[model samples]
Target: MKNKTVAAWLAFVGGPLGLHRFYLHGMGDTLGWALPIPTALGLYGIQRVQQFGQDDQLSWVLIPLLGFTIAACALVAILYGLRQPQQWNARFNPQASADAPAGLTNWFTITAIAAALMVGAAVLMASLAYSFQHYFEYQIELAREISQ
Candidate 1:
């Protein structure tokens, strides 16, 4: 059975790759296998953009997809951390004795939760800022054209 702390840490550290899902649910989890696809595309897109230029339009799509994936992973980590020990144990380690130690409140779990929240919030804010900037720039261009 997978330990909750280990699963939480894996989710926080490598959720984009579905590492936590794989750890808890095994390799059969398609979502876990699929989660890394966007990350890989995003990384390749980033390299291409850096080597060539922003003209690599694919990067525009890949980067945001990757960002969303990361934010989703962070959310998973937070949810895992916040899950009650009893529920987690019941779901993942039902065969284990009730007296078995549930590692929910450990330092590592706490750190993972905090890190996930911070990273998720930062990514969300950055995405919002980028959207607003582009929207305002378009508005400014429209206004200038109307004034002319």
Candidate 2:
């Protein structure tokens, strides 16, 4: 049976890598397989930033993919953590009894929820800020050129 605490922590820490998805959904999950694409692109974006610097347009677009993916996973984790034992069992462990210990929320789950919230919010905000800042700066440059 899938354990709630483990799933929550996995989603918070390894969500970008799709570890939590794999744990809950198994290897055949297509979306689980797809999770790494944005993560890789984001990593590549970081590499681009390091190599070409932050002014690189492609990196500006790519970096946020990673952040958004991470934030999404964190959101997923929060959702999992908040689920009632009955609901969690009904969904993820249908074969098990309604009161299965696997579905119970505990300190670990709460910690995972708190951590996911903190990190996800920060990453999401940072991504939005980065994208907007670059986009507006680019627009400003274009305006200046036109005004010249």
Top-TM-score candidate index: 2
What lDDT would each prediction earn against the true structure? 0.79, 0.95
What are the per-residue Cα lDDT tens digits for candidate 1 across 27-119?
Answer: 999999999998898678678779888655566666666777788888888888888877887888888764456635588888989999999
Clashing pairs in 2: none
Writing each residue's lDDT as its tens digit, candidate 2 over 1-148 gives 9999999999999999989989999999888899999999999999999999878999999999999999999999999999999999999999999999999999999999999999999999999999999999999999999999
The reply for model 2, stretches above 4 Å from the true place, is: none
lDDT of residue 55 for candidate 2:
87
What's model 2's lDDT at 97? Answer: 99
C-alpha positional error of residue 16 in candidate 2 after TM-score superposition, expressed in Å: 0.6
CA lDDT for candidate 2: 0.95
TM-score, candidate number 2: 0.98
The clash count for each model shown is 0, 0
lDDT of 1 at 120: 87
